[model samples]
Target: MAHTKASNTPSPRTIIPTPVNSTADFAAQQRNMSADNASQGSGVKLKKEIGLLDGVAIIVGVIVGAGIFVSPKGVLLYSGSIGQSLIVWILCGILSMVGALCYAELGTMIPKSGGDYAYINVAFGPLPAFLYLWVALLVIIPTGNAITALTFAQYLLQPFWPSCDAPVEAVQLLAAALTSLLTVINCYNVRWVTRVTDVFTGTKIFALLVIVAVGIWYLCAGHTDHWNEPMRGTFTAPGLIALAFYNGLFSYAGWNYLNFVTEELKDPYRNLPRAICISMPVVTLIYVITNVAYFTVLTPEEILSSDAVAVTFGDKMLGFMSWLMPFFVACSTFGSLNGSIFASSRLFFVGARNGHLPAAISLINVHCLTPVPSLIFLCVITLILLFIKDVYTLINYVSYVEALFTTLSVSGLLWLRHTQPKTERPIRVSLALPIIFLITCLFLVISSVFQSPIEVGIGTAIIISGIPVYYLTIHRPVEWLRNLSQSFNLWCSKFFICMPNQEKFD
Candidate 1:
């Protein structure tokens, strides 16, 4: 086991030290790592157990979750037509691919675990990075988990409530309970989590592929009625289109999830881009065709009326096996929620390691080698958010904040291109790609203000609220406050059976 270095203040960050052995960094003076063998510069000791396939499973599992099973309804509603919704799905996939490629450069170059927070910290500095962390840890991460959990609970409860909506209290309680269960599982074992991810990834993909096959067969059996007016009712307003994208892009949210655990991925330089290449196109295709499948079997009114589209599709198509659809969808969402919890905890852990969050959150369990404290904190917040009733509203808040920070991240990437011209980039993307993605994403963030002013304003306030938190928490603390923080850290260490993360034990 590694001995943790105790500190009251956050670590200084001219560079985050990633140790090769006991004490020496992978690089003498650097935050950026190069090539397949190099580890991320996160300093905290986490294993590289994730292979290329595991990486693919992680991205696919997380992205293809409740969104695909759930978001088509929102896409169809906001897009105002089956045709427009399909276009949004395709465009969102392309947009995700572009942004992911930009992140590939950032991941291979910096190879850090915190994702946007790490990239922003290196390119801009801690303040901007901390602000991203603030919105993410509070609003984005928990709400996403809450949404997934709620979706899972809804589907799991569907067999009982075959005709009507599940009770609100029942849904919320089940969601909270499920979130807690996954958190405990995550805190127990890292390898077990990946194994669960791999298995569930296959299950969800199979479920989606089943839908696509059935739809294709239905399409081939001379059922072309739904294609007569594809563009009929498409929304022309930019705000509505962007809102549709919020649903579409929300389904594609986990494309960059692998970057959050860069340190845990084996041969990141080779595996990261390879996983993205293999996973993105496949996920995009499944999403589009699955929506096509939905329209093929069910009318737009039917889709709009149902809460769980996939379940309804199964019910209409699967006959006596209708129960199996809910079962498969339930398993799919369980895996997705698991993946979200896994990746999000790592983000908070890395943030704490950099001193942007509570010092206790940086600690790794001596026995399990997972960041138990961070996982628990994430579970607590997610459970709290599960109390919020509107799942779609959570998705919008997630999308709104998601677009804002991702735009900032690409902006930071461009800044790095100007500032660190000579940095070794194992995977450098074209400058034009990030620029185009940045502009397009910025538009999505702005367009939301016109459509959902209250949500956008609330997102803005959440981000701005981080300013005071940064100043008070990370920047300056009075003597008594510092002492109180020390005592809190001590209690957390003793209770959680953890110590601060170190580069190496020896």
Candidate 2:
């Protein structure tokens, strides 16, 4: 006979004496234990190996992607002068800073990953949060990554191609490969991802500084004709300025990507806000100086006429060194793609953990300690999007929805404050911050509605498409579907060698 402990913990029997009958029996027992853990609602969790500099890298890398190089023309097109262009850049920076402050407070209070998804889930409810996730899954995050990768491919391949327009097949194939590369990188340990981001972030910053330095040299040597005519073709129409600001906002889009990985950041309460505070202002200054540099080297007419502003600026200013611009743009866009995969995968992981998505996506590789399933899922979705032509048109259809959800997210700050007054806040801003950001977001959405009603309608319809999904999953989930989801999740865990652990949410 064998004896067993008499404690409260459950046991297989009153008297436990049997050993494993075979290795197969041991493997079966392990699988059963994992399945039980999964049924108990436990999941894999993220490790916090990131720091302040890592956070800043994510923000700067994602925010500075290819946009600053190309968008000068768009800004100058609408602003009609260097002064107005600079103003738009600075104002968008301030708006981003205020928005970051609000997010910092929320990130600390909740102290979770998922960024806006976590904040909105707590402040509003699951329905609205699910809707946000639906759009993110189908549109916002994937399209954003696809656009960045396509841009990267376009710039990287432009040198070899004879025409100004890159060959469409080459661009698409290379973009897909780029996405696959970054996805594989992120599926490993977190440090690998941040390390890549930091190095590329440094590279892009150095490239920008080179441009700024050359511009300063030109200005010092008296290339000042454009400086004298700062407001010549100014279009101060409400619609035009709104549109200009809208474009500027797109360039400033990735400031909040850092917040998405809050769980992975060391000392997040202090570092999250500090990273945002540092990166936003620095990027703002870079944008202003870089635009000034562009205008210093290229006249407004040349700037407008050129298809690629930074390339033109390089050709005009850098002389023999003009060959470096395309490489720099490619690096910048590659970093953005890597950082986007890093951040957006976390959103999917968190959403999956919370039952908003299939639990398989929440799996973390035991050896790698990364969200393998989520990363792979995002890779497939983004790769599918890579096949779609006209990335800008696809992005435009969802821009309104992106702005609307961001407004809803920032508004969560106010809603949470009123509802959860006692929640601890490590970096609270004045009420005016979120209030002001929400107003700006609302103006953008409303103005877009008036300006592009049809596109806005399409975006709204895409979001509304999630309702039936919501009803099927949350409101009226089927037993067979749940069983199938659980079985699939178990299979993935076993295949990936995942070790199930209890996930914590604040």
Candidate 3:
């Protein structure tokens, strides 16, 4: 029975009673049950229901989010010309594909949840992994959810605010509600999550196709002027181009996260790679076509001036159907929230399972077959973020950190080839894939740092701050920390109602 490893179940090879004493004891006790170990009878497992299509939906659903609708303006602002903007989008697609292929290799190799956390833990060590986890929990997941939720709220309520400037408080409230709704939805089961993802993915894709179709029809009907002066209004500075890449890359962010739930995917070794290969190209083509549709109607000035580029395009092109654009954009953002909540919860579950976080965070609802505790935690954090003023500004801080960790995670391909060459790699990528992705990631990080040193410093400091916390909880394992974890687990079990109580790892 070659199954995915469960977060709560220890490997049968090592039996241990509850309440382990020291950090070393806990670390040694928590087995890294890879695919090989599971075949030897590790009852610990997650239900594998995600098929090829579901896996592809998760990738596509998360990647094609509010960024695509909003990022084009930033790209045009720096791209210096319409042609350069399109070129940047294409280059980003290529860059994302390279990174996705590299991760496909790593995902099959590890076949575990936690995405970057799993890869970094294996290649470098636990400390670096812990730092990544720290940033992920605190920044990456919450900020992303908040940003998407806000985007969703804006679009959903855009009709009321015809001027497109909705009240900040009203938007945050709706965003909070949206985050809570998705979190609750994800608490059901993997099947439900995938079903919702499939429907939403289809809806958004259909919407994009509608846009593409109409754009082509409109172009055929005489919207040739925008294409004629493609280079009319473009900006051409190095810093600006670099910033454009950042925006474009952000739109392509979620392509790597399908690996976060690898344990839940059916025949992960084969399906994971297939899903990545299929989703990235589809998303790229859709994105390119959608941009073409936008340029078909809106000029560079129109695009740069509008807060919601998609809505503006709709207003210009669609007769009475312009009203539908906000609804479609809301659907896209909501789907993105679903995907983010689903993936981020797995990181918390994996972090707790690996003994880097509170043991309570690992609780899974056996009946529901979901990481309930982790999902709730993410929802709560996202809700908190909704209250913060200028949450979108926080994106740059996490973006810098995201690029750094992604670079490190992709480099694992090179490291593991040297260190664990004999380890079964069902899908190995070319050496150049990781190299190219790393160079691209490094360039993004360096450019962003030069442009926004303060934000980069904040991100770096947050990662470094994890070092002492890591020492306190993981390295030293203080008695107070043990008590705190135990209390937290107890509180979570009691309050969350549905979350199952697993034996504490500590």
Candidate 4:
């Protein structure tokens, strides 16, 4: 009897599902299963596979783009003092790190894919979440991508045309083409996309590091003429210092890109938090050192007056390598474009999935397991932005709204801390940290409001436009108020009413 145990096992193919429920339900089930199957087929067994290195690469790649190349001049113009400008950079780095820490906690707790959208939705409800998504999709991501792409194209073209005179239309077209090509490459394979990002990010970091080292050596070799200049009167003013700090903060953007891919990051609860913490300090160090080098080799007056500080620095360091600086700048901007495209498409995909955007955009390719529709949508929008005449103006307008939403997102951290105190937290920062972050973000938002009223008006119009579209596409006119009330009530309860029980006291 013991020897009679059966050796036969049913083949996986032989096990077919016995259907139950209406055709619609069955179809829905099949669609989900197919999506799951596609994910499996791509050998993407863990969305959480991204490690510390990938996280660092994303943070650095996003932060070190055209901002550093173009921003130093602005910072110098605003600060008018090398020492004061360096201090502004340091303060900005610290503020960014604080905000990043707050975000790290939220990201780990949610462990979802959408980054700020998910956090805002959970804490503030659908309307705010939708607005955040709308602003990001329509203004921030597209304009940001265009700026980076345009910067890349400009730098690449600079070497060929040493005169630095080129047709604006030609640069715009080239930028658009570059963005579209990168979007296609990313849509094809996630692994290859990551590899390309790694290469570009590495190249930019190496170039910057070399520039820093050369500047140090040159300073040691009697290049101190720029270091002992009298402090400029403009830099002595507090208002100018504030402006430089804001500019420095803008250059340090992308501290939060890693949070967008939480679902794909392995051990997000641990790795995501650690990645942000580690990357912030590393980037801050790089930025500080780079500024010191610039100040050592070139005066504030020189930097404020120069269009290409990095190129000037390179020429000073090694005459021959001056030709190579533009290539490095191109690589830096390209990496930033790639990172922005990668992170931002996920926001669209999540919005579409949640019925906040057009459902068609939620489509996932069965073979590649990528959100092809969202990717294409992003590409088209970026192309449109490329036609806009001024990248700086676009960035300013988009950043104002982005800073507003970011302020909202940071407020969500405080709201969640009070409301969901009993909920398990994967990462925890000190209470003071969030308070500092909220204050910093609120300051930035207020500053933005005062700095560019017209741009803020345009950004508000873009957000309000979404409400009508939402009603037409998803909600009935009669029930619109009812749904809105329900959403408001939910936000209040989750963010205000639902305090933690006694055992979990903060």
Ranking by TM-score: 2, 3, 1, 4
For model 4, how does the per-residue alpha-carbon lDDT over 295-371 read when each residue is reduced to its tens digit?
88876767877777887877766787687788888999999888888878878877766777655455454335556
| Deviating ranges (above 4 Å) for candidate 3 | 1-44, 232-236, 494-506
The TM-score that candidate 4 achieves is: 0.85
Q: Which ten residues in a row have the lowest lDDT in candidate 4?
A: 497-506
Could you give candidate 3's per-residue lDDT for residues 356-429 as a string of tens digits? 99877886653465788888888888889899887777777777888899989987779999989899988888
Q: Best-fitting candidate, measured by TM-score?
A: 2
Global lDDT of model 4? 0.74
Task: Give lDDT per model, in order.
Answer: 0.83, 0.84, 0.82, 0.74
TM-score of each: 0.89, 0.91, 0.89, 0.85
Q: Where is the poorest 10-residue window by lDDT in model 2? A: 9-18
* Candidate 1 lDDT tens digits, 351-456: 9888888787987765677899999999999888887656456655556788888998999889999989999999999889999999898889889878888888
Residue lDDT tens for model 2, 1-506:
13356765332212121244443553465566556555755434577898988889999999998889887788878787888988998999999988889889988998888988988899899989999999999989998999899889988998897466888889999999999998988987788999999999998998899899999999999879888978888888766787888889889998888888888899998899999999999999999999889988888889889877888888887788887898899999999889999999989988988899988797677556788889999999999988876656877888888889889989888988998898889888998889999999998889898878888998999999999999887778888887677677766666665543345554
Winner on TM-score between 3 and 4 is 3
RMSD (Cα, Å) for all candidates, in order, is: 7.2, 6.0, 5.6, 8.6
